[model samples]
Each structure stands twice: as structure tokens, then as C-alpha cells.
Target chain A: MLFLKRYLPLVICGFTGVVFGIQYYVPHKASEDLLTFINDWMIIIFGFSMILALASLFHVHYQKIRRRQSGWGFSLIVFIAIIVTVIIGIISQGETVDEKGLTSFGWIYTNMLVPLSGTMFSILAFFIASAAFRAFRARTLDAFLLLFAAIIIMFGRVPAGEYLWSKIWGAEFPLQMGDITEWIMGVLNMAARRGILLGVALGAIATSLKIIFGIERAYLGEKE
Target chain B: MRSIFHLLIFLLIEGQAFSQELTPPKELKAFDAPYDSGNVLYLTWKGMPYDSEKVDYIVYISESEEGPFFEIGRFKSNTHFKADKNWPAWAWKRTTEYHYFEISSFIKEGKEIPLENGKTYFLKLLVTDGIKQVKSNVVSAFPKGNLFNLLKLNNLIYMIIFSVIILWFIARAKKRELFLRKIPALEAIEEAIGRSTEMGRPIYFLTGRLGMSSVSTIASTIILGEVAKKVATYGTEIKVPHTDPIVMSVCQEITKQAYISAGRPDAYREDSNFFITEDQFSYTAAVDGLMVREKPAACFYMGYYYAESLLLSEVGASIGAIQIAGTDAEHQLPFFVTTCDYTLIGEELYAASAYLSKNPVLMGTLRGQDVGKGFLMGAVFIGTGLATLGTITGAMQIVSFVLDWFKGF
Candidate 1:
């Protein structure tokens, strides 16, 4: 049981990882075939995982409704939505739109799901405003710099900044808000982003190597 | 069929009306394109006749020239140099003038038939001056699947070096104790968990919306294992709302194992880790609802996030939850920083598992990653210095040549 549960999985993980890692260097047809085979396996695995997701969704809501929890009504609504969507989805061949045009499933998706998801996404604009109100506060030196950069970016992103700059400065001034904004974004921002990217890339490589070598078994529900 | 019949009639009339002649392109050659997939080959021809205003070239491909051939594509006479293919200068040698076209596949009736490895393909280039047509001599080349791509050799070398550094550190760690600097945010996790226990409110953990495929998510789950163990130790409730089923399943096992480790196995509820909808905004909305309703004493947001990072954190903040956010997603960092009490910026998220676990293997990997970052920082500084020096000394070509060696595949 121990071997079957732990050692076997780890061995498979290490072997498969090494193969895929080497695949990055080899452009041979055999390597390409390996990639395709692995990708197909991942797709199959994802399909099975989706079943678990559906079951989990049902379980959570079912328990919620059974206990008459705070959002019992919402849980009931979830159950209804899942059932209805599933039926329509399977009947419609799971396509939002077919050659014949929008089916009942497509209509529900277009009308209900799209608008709901869109409305949820649209809430981020308000969230950003509130967050920005807090973030851009000039409480400290870092905050002040952020505020200054934000102000410049906000102004210079529009055409009026250039027009106002040329008008107010009367063509003698060497610097423009637009140019400063560009410098901040292109040079300063790029430098910071690249630094973060470097760290992230290195960390990613380390993490992948650790996992591939079975030194990091946290993903397998073992040591961190 | 009808179009060909009409073209035949039209060409017969045009042939009588004009006497301008066309010649085959000079110095035609077909060869395997270097530093590319085995499926593609380059066809180059010199000196397209400039005597006519309306000249068109057509490319054809076949197994053999004796029988059928199909037009793959057509293009007007234009300068297509070998240098323009965008293969790095180190790999591509012939920068001289020639009209070049990359032919990877033969198309017929909207279907592509890519060159199979080890299969010889015959190709022809035809030129027409809108009056007469001429065909170039058939050229043949066989595609060979390159056993190795030398362009990525530098990357492979760097990876091997980094792995060696990590392995060396791992071996060293087993022999001696290693010190890790205190991360205040990680320190505050215990305090936050204690608060949740005292308040009798559950702590909420979000693994973001990404799946296990993402590095950030993997890191998040590892951190979750540590967090779960800590939660078990403190007897604080931990509810993890997930976006990926595989991640949720893994988290379930991790949490259970943590509980077992802490001698509180019976207290570990399977429902502690639950799957939320995979839809981005939907999951965000659901988490927000949970935060608002449950009024969790603390919220731990870890892993990759998009726009919803702010939405969830803002709600958590509004509920007075001690929100700690960690993600490698740089763009979302500002949002997380604004709304959360503590934010793990960039690679700090990756280091969190090692920092929390204090396990030698993970700690060694983290140290090695730090060393790798140090090397990168030095490289960047040196590259910048060399570039500035080159600008001053007018030795930019040498600097650029050195820099191109570091550029990726």
C-alpha cells in the first residue's frame, strides 16, 4: 500500500517530469510525439477532474441546504442553476453557438451567465477606485512616489496632457508630462518588472526542479 | 474547370497581343532552414526579373516532379532576404541578397500537409510577366528531424548549473543548520490564526483561481500544508475555497495529513477544502459572499490572481479580517498590497513554503533560488554597465554580440 500510494506516484512523477524537461531541449520528432502524448493525457485527466468538481459543487450546496445555513436559499438556487445548465448543455452538445444559431443553452449562457459574470467583473472598476484611494495616499516616501507616478500616468495617457504641456510651457521647456510618463513606464516600470520577472523565473525553475526530483513532495500531500 | 477554360481563352488572346517574355529566377536553391523545426525548409531564388510591372511568383510542391503538383501559395516579387527570417545571427550565416520563402507545408483545398521528417519534397518556382510563364528547375530537399536544438543549449546549461547549485545546497543543508531571515508576514500568520481561534471565527483561505499547473498555485498549496498544520496546532478552523478540483483534492489530503500530524485527525473535516466555480468572476463573487457572511477573523489569499484579487481582499478587509496576500503575479501585487494587511511580493510567495516549513530540502531550494537571483542581478548590472560603456566607447557591436548569447530560444 505504501509503495502503491507513494513510491509509485513519485517515481512516475520524476520520470515523466524528466522526460518533459528534456523535451524542451530536443526538437526531434520523437520528442514532439512525447509532447503530444502527454498533452492528450493531461486533457483526459482534466476531463476526470471536472467530474470531481461537479460532485464537489453539488456536495457543498447540498450540505448547505441540508443544514439550512445562512445562504441556504442561495445554495438551492445553485442546485437549480447547475441542474438546468447541465441538462441544456448536454442537449445542446455543450456549444454556446452552433451553425443553426443560438440554442436554448446558448441563450441561457449569453443572457444569464455572460451578464452575471460581466457584472461581477465590472465590480472590479469600483474595487479599483476604492483600492486606489487607499493605495495612492501620500502617507510615506514610497506612497508619495506611487502617487506622483499615478498622477503622471493618469494625465499623460490622454491627449490633453501633450496639448496642455506644449501650451503652458510655451515650447521652451525640454520636459513634457507625456515624455516623463513614458520614461516612468518604459524605463523605470520596465526595470522593476524585469527584476520581479527574474526572481519569479528563477523561483519557478527551482520549484519545478525540486518537484521533478521528488525533493518537494508538498504537491503530493507530503512534506512542504 | 470553368475558370481554367476562361483563363485559357483569355491567355490565348493576351499572348497574341503582347510579346514580352519571362525568365526563370536565377540561382534557385532549396535547403533545410537552420535553428528551426524539422518540418520547415527555406527556398531562395535570386534576381526576379524586374523588366515587367506585373510579375507574380507561385510555389508548388510534390513528391516527384513527373506528375501532379499543387500550388501552395503565391506572392508578388519582393525582396526576401535570408536575414529577414528572424533566426538569430549566430545560427543564420547567409545574409546575402536573395528572395527567400519558408515552405513547411503543402496546402490543398484548405488542408495543410506538413513536411514529414525523412521525406523528400520536390518544389518548383514559377514566374509570370502577365503575358508569358516560365518554370524554374525542380529542386528537392529532405527534412531531417534535428536531434538537438543548439540554440537552447545556453538555457540548458544555465538550468543544469542552477540545479547543481540547489543540489549542493541540499547536500550541505543535511550536515549543518541553515539560517533563514524572518519574514514578518509569516510571523503574523500565527498571530492571525490565534486571533481566529480566540474569536471562534473560521479562517478563510483562497488558493486563487489558477490550477495546479501554475507555479504560484503549486507554491500556494505547499504553503497551505504549512498553514493547515498551524491551524490544527492552534485548534483554529480553516476553510479553503478552491477553484481547481485537482487542487482541492490535493488540499484535502494535505489538510487531513496536517491534522493527523497535529494529533487532531478527528477535527479535520473533509468539507474544509471545497471547490468553488472555476469561472473567474463567479469564484470571486462567491468568495466575497463567504467573507461577508462568515465574517472570518482572517483571510489568507495565496497563489495567482487576476482582477478579482482586489475584490476579494477588499471584502476581507471590510470585514476586518487580517488579510495576508501572497502571489507571484506582479500586476496584482499593488492591489493585494492595498487591500491586504501583508503582501508577499513576487518570489517571496515561492519562498513562503520553505520559510514556513523549515524543511532542509525546500530551504535549500529557496537559498539556491536566491543565489540564482543574485547572479541575475549581477548580470543585469554588468550588462547595463557594458551597454553604457559601449555607448561611450563606440564598441556597441561587441556588447550586443555578447548580450545576444544570453537571449532565449
Candidate 2:
């Protein structure tokens, strides 16, 4: 039974994998229907997964409250928040974000969640500036080049340089400062991007080939 | 002085007679070359009555109006004749300046009519039969410099620079000197796992939303394998909470392999690697709960990540665990940079596995990437120079041709 359970999922996966692989080449209605059925099954599975996660959340917190853990009061608050939202959601006929019900869920999402999330994201700006300061130090040849390129880009992107100097000697040369910046971005930056993309592409192709060929069979959970 | 006075008197009489007999063609204009070679001058004139049957028209070109008109070419019938096209390619390489061209038609079997250089030419056509021909009215035009020349020059410089960089990188990688710099986030895997073991708290490895196929996720998995080995060797527990089911399974094998490699096959726990929800927010919530409940000593977030980067990082931070994160997504880099103790940015995420393993093949690939980067830098230098020079000289035909070739892709 253990062996069957271990191998059965692999076999089932292999069969389905081949079917899906062949579907890519086949243009028949039956193949299309099969793909649609698979998609529908995926949606059903996703729905069940969400339900399972919610149940798990409720169980964990319910136990926490019952056992009266150190943060049990916070768990109770979360429980109350979730219960109230669900009840309001159902009673308002799924009008969770409707203007009539805006004072409740809308206020929570807008005032609490959105600002919290935005604040979390905005914290990165300071971090990036600090990282840049540390990372862009000219400790080595490569670091020097990186720092130079970054500074050029920063100067080139803004309009202040042109206003500061309109001419070099007698000739007009306002946009000359951006020349190096453009070159770095258009050439050096693009090449690095292409190299990364190529490696990623090859890795993706290899992994997909492995999956389609049934050489990889890890998605199935533990055997009975 | 006496002969000049007689000639002037005779020219005045002839000019008066010529003006009274023939009306000049109206709206005569010269346009710059439309395409291809730049030296061609376009001449348009209001057609005279006798233009249709005119078999031969005499066109004279000269540098000045005073005298010495040279016959550059003769148009047998057509109204338009390009000076550059008619002349040898090399001859038209001189400076672009103003020149003059005039046309006049002859009467068959009539005395050869000489056209004077000083007078403005009118639209004149020769009505010719086998036996006879007549002159039509004359026309005039003035020419100017062609302007679309510089765009071509800029393009050439760009192409050369781009090609040079790409080639340079490829060559350098081939020569085997492209050792990419070390990334710390990748280097800390074993240390993080060992720390977890000493602390007696399980290590938590979360491959972000990216599936197994993602480059970041693959790098993460490779690192995970190495970390798992250390955990197994130390008889330490580790849990891989995966957002992707596919990645979860990969993690399970990786964990299993680590245990086997560490000579602790019996210590491997399959349930330790399990799929949490795939939805971004839900996954974050679940992982947050796990962090709170399990209080893992170390957390690694390496893969594609988004807004949840902070939520996860902050939760892990609150637990007082050491955290290391790496990703290539530009938007998410900032989050990892701020929140994680060590974060790999952009290409470093892709370079992590090779850096950690130091396998020759992976190292070779990294070397290849450096070669590509070098080639790019060289191209940038040359392209900028050519474009700048082309602008200064205002001679852009060659540059434009080069640019057109570069833009072929």
C-alpha cells in the first residue's frame, strides 16, 4: 500500500503530463475540451485550498484563545475582525465595498491596510539609498564602474545639468552630459539584461522538459 | 573699351527683342535631393506649349552667373536630371554649395541658338519634327542644402557600439576571466542552517511566489539543497513552506537528498516540506502564522517576491531570526534591501547558485555573462564617440548608413 501510494501519484502525473504535452501540438476540439476541464479542476482545487487555509487559520487561533497563550488577546481581536467582516459581507449581499457599507470594511481597508502596505513598500527607498551608498563605494574596479554608471544615470535623468551649463567653450552642448548615461543604459545595461534572460530561459526550458518527460515527480505529498 | 560699348548696346537690343517675343515659364523652383545620393538637385518648371515634342534640350551648369557655363549633362527629353547621378560617384564628393543649371531647346536645321548665362532662364521647350523645331518659354530655379543627413550618422555609431560590447563580452567569457563577484545572501545558507541547529530551532526556507521553473526559484532550491544538507548533518529540523506546489515537491526531494547525502536518511521528514496557499496575501498570512507559532531560528526568502516581502521580513524580524533574501525583480529588490539582513539584487540573484556551488560549468556561465557585460561597455564608448563627431561635422550620410544597418534587427 505504501509503495502504491508513493508510485500512483507519479503514474497519474505522468499520464496527465503526457496528455497536456500532446495537447500543445494537437488542434482538435477534444484536446481543447480536455484543457478546459483541467483548467476548471484547477479552479476547484484552488477554491478548496483557500477553504483549507481559512480553516487552518481558525483552528490555530481558536486553540490559541482556548489555551490562553501570551498573545491570546490579539488572536481574539483577529477572530472578532474576521467574524465581523464575514457576517457583514453576507448580510450586505456581497456589497463589501459598496458606498452604503463604506463606514465599516471600506474604512478598515483604506485607513489601516492600504497605508500599512504602502508604508511597508516606501521603507525600501531609504534602504535602497543606504545600499547604494555602501554598494557603490569604489572598493574595486567593478565597483568603481558601477558607481560611475549609477552617478551618470542619476545626473542624466534630471533636467538640472542642462540649466547649469549650456555650452562647453563656445558651442552649445546642453544634452552632452546624458550621452554617457544613454550609452551605459542602452548598451551595457541591455547586454547584462540579455545574459540573465538567456540563462533564465535555458533553465526554464530544461525544467519544463524534465517535468514533461516525468523525470521530476515531487509535487505529490507523502504516501500513506 | 570701344568694343565693350558696342557689345552692350547690341545685348540690350537683343534682350529687349527676346523678352517681347517669349514669355518666361512661371513658378520655377529647385528642391533638395529626395532620396539616396545627396547631390541630386530637383528642378520643376511650368511646362511650355512646345515641351511635348522637344527632342533635345541643352542644360548648362556653372559656379557663377557672370560667365564660363559648363555643359554638365544633356537631358534628351526628361525634365529632371540629377547632377550626382549623371556625374561619377567620386566627382560629387565635393562640398555642398550653391550651383546653377539652365535649359534651352533648339530648332531643327536652324542656326544653333546660344543661351546667355547672365539672364534668368525661362521654361523653354523645343517642338521638333524630322525637319524642324522651335524654342518655348524659359524658367529659373535656386537650390539649397539637404537636411536629413545627420540621423544616418547617429545610427551607425549606435550600431557599432552595441555590436562591439556584445562581442567583447562573448570573447572575454571565452578567455575564462569572467569570475563574477561573490554574493553574500547565497554564501550565508550553510551558516544560517548551522545557526538554526545550534539554537535548536528549525530553519524555515520559503521559496517566494516563483514556481520551480523560475530562475530565482531554481537558485533558491539549489541553495535550499545545500542548507538542507547542513541541517541533516547536524540533526537539526527544517521546514520548507512553499507557495508553489511544484516547488514544494522539489523542496521535498531536495530535503530528502540532503538527508541522504548527510548520512542521515532516517532523519528526513517529508511532511516538513509542504505547500501553503499560492495566493500572495494568504501565503503571507500563513507564513506569518508559521513564523509566530514555530519561531524558527533562521528564515530564507529567495525567489520572485512582491509586496509580501516586507510582511514576511518584518514577521521574521520580530521573531528575532536571522534573515537572508535574494530576488531579481527590480520592484521587490528595495523591500529585500531594507528588510533582510543580506539581500541579493538583480543579476546577483541569478548568479547565486553558481557562486555558492562554484561548479566549473556554472562558473563558465557566469564568466560568459561577464564577457557579455564587457562587450556592452565597449559598444557604449564607441557609439557615443561616433555620434558626437557626426553631430559636429554635420556630415551624417555615412553615419546614417551605419545606423540603418545596426537597426536591421
For each candidate, the alpha-carbon lDDT, in order, equals 0.84, 0.59
- Scoring each candidate complex against the real one, what DockQ results? 0.63, 0.05
Taking the tens digit of each residue's C-alpha lDDT, what string does model 2 give over B112-158?
44333233432323334334545433334332333233324434354
lDDT of 1 by residue, B47-166 (tens): 543533377788888888674788877877654566565444566544545778888888766788888877888889888766678999999888877777877777887888999999
Residues forming the 10-long window of minimal summed lDDT in candidate 2 chain B? B90-99
List TM-score (chain A only) for every prediction.
Answer: 0.93, 0.78
Please give the interface root mean square deviation for model 2, in Å.
12.8
The alpha-carbon RMSD over the true interface for every model, in angstroms, is: 1.5, 12.8
What tens digits encode model 1's per-residue C-alpha lDDT throughout A1-224? Answer: 99987889789889988988888888887888889998898889988998988888888899999899998898998888888988999999898888889998999988988999999888889988988999988999999999998988988999887788889886678998778999999999998888888888998888888888888887777754
* lDDT by residue for model 2 (A36-143), tens: 998898767666656645654565567769999767786697789788877766665555477565655566666766775566557556546655676677999988
Deviation from native of the Cα of residue B299 in model 2, angstroms = 3.0
Each prediction's RMSD over C-alphas, in Å, is: 7.8, 17.4
Error of 2 at B130 (Å): 44
